[model samples]
Target: MFFLKYLPTQSLILNYQEHFPDGAEPKIASRLEMLREASLLLRDLEDFFRAHDFSLTRFLICVILDRADEQGGLQHSEIVERIDVSSPVISRSLKSLIDERFVCVESETEGRRTKRNRLTDAGKARLQSLMPGYYEILLK
Candidate 1:
């Protein structure tokens, strides 16, 4: 989301006419409007997730796991790759989800230290519950 909730007014954009070449003004105005609308959309998504006791990150994780092999879910490193976030943050969130009984991990091999993360039945249910609200937020 945009750090500045208060975007510049149209008059302020108009004032930039003197600084730019002739036709560039309209392009600049269009870009600003796009950014402003995108920012508002992101904020709405954030709020909707928060109200449902969920986080976007967690929801993304669930979505990824939903497509993984049923017998074994995605590896931690795989999730990190898919989400493009720091491993520590993924680990922390995974830990929380495990504690909440929303997720489980299985050792990949007898002696291997690696584990795969999978959503428990409860986790799947929770994700299912959130989908409708999430869709409404977008379509509305």
Candidate 2:
């Protein structure tokens, strides 16, 4: 999403070469273009999720849990380790999911104090319903 609208990129790169000939990184243009494209893709995904009234964070957490699925589900710490998001955001989203009946917290079979978050049957159904649209956006 970062672009020099007033100046063409080649012009900007040429200007940089004129000013800092030795410091001109040969791959800067390609790197910037890559980053810009990635940013725009992410922006589109965010817009799509919002348009559906769904959260990308919650969706990611669901995906992580689904992939690492066990009867008792994954522990809170395990969820944190899988995702790049901050703990508090994960905590808030995870907690809301429980309230929405999409996820449930249960004790481990062994006598551990740790809590595990499992997706409900309803949750699985919701995930199934969302996947087609999600793939559509990705494939698009």
Candidate 3:
């Protein structure tokens, strides 16, 4: 069970509680409220990325690629682990990025069979463009 020291979301809690059975636990109701709030925030963030013509996953890949060393790139497994996403999700995002000229596969191999990835100049620029607004939101 998740516990918060202070829950300042009274209206949200009330709304969520109304849908549950009469004797539902307060903890469950509050958890639902928190989940609802998180979902809304995530949706807004996704919409912001979409407005810039990029999905959230693709934007994240650009960030990861941009942070790699000048002469090194991230391997497919590295990206999957760092992003905490499934293989197919990372694969699709990488494919979209490659098609958009935002990312590329480096010829250099990490090990026996690992293919490395790096961001193109276009990807760096795109990330830079979004950074100001992103930072503003975070700072607030």
Candidate 4:
């Protein structure tokens, strides 16, 4: 019983091959299949991130912050371009991180409506803690 529950995901993936015919499955896989791969891989990371009080948006914001340009922050517009997420989507994410003291926002010089965002020390620390597990799955 314990063995049944302990099977690794990699093992299950290997076994899924039996359901398909020989040389029939796309070796390179399609875009939809790639999306499926992303979905499955994210499941493990999502559980880990959730333990750290992160949603996918929050986790993605951390990634954005980590890759920010000159100001150690990115403009809201820039973040949307890089992540392909909507402004409202990132707005909610920024709010959560801000409330948690994991990030800060600065009004743009040009206008109050525009804002730049950066990760806080706490956010970086949390990201550091979560990195190893994230890296392990991503590298697989």
Lowest summed-lDDT stretch of 10 residues in model 1?
Answer: 1-10
Residue 139 in model 1: shift from native, Å?
1.2
List model 4 lDDT by residue over 1-140, tens digit each: 01122223544454677876765345424433566666777776777778766776787778779777356698877878878678899888888888998888887676568778888889888778878877887888
Q: Could you give candidate 1's per-residue lDDT for residues 37-136 as a string of tens digits?
A: 7777778888988998778888888888887857589898899999977999888878888898888898899989988888999999988999998888
> How many residue pairs clash per model?
0, 0, 0, 0
Q: Quick one: best lDDT, which candidate?
A: 1
Error of 3 at 81 (Å): 0.7
What lDDT score goes with residue 11 in model 4?
Answer: 44
Ranking by TM-score: 2, 1, 3, 4
Model 1 whole-model lDDT (C-alpha atoms): 0.84
Roughly what TM-score does model 3 have, to 2 decimal places?
0.70
Identify the candidate with maximal TM-score: 2
Report the lDDT tens digits of candidate 3 across residue range 1-140.
Answer: 23344555656666767676865657776666777666655666677788888877888888888888574879888899889789999999999999988888876735555578999888888889988866665454
Task: Name the regions of candidate 3 deviating beyond 4 angstroms.
Answer: 1-33, 109-113
lDDT for 137 in candidate 4 is: 73
Clashing pairs in 4: none
Regions of model 2 farther than 4 Å from truth: 1-8, 17-26
Give the alpha carbon lDDT tens digit for every residue of 50-105 in model 2. Answer: 88667888888888777767656899888889898889999999988898888999
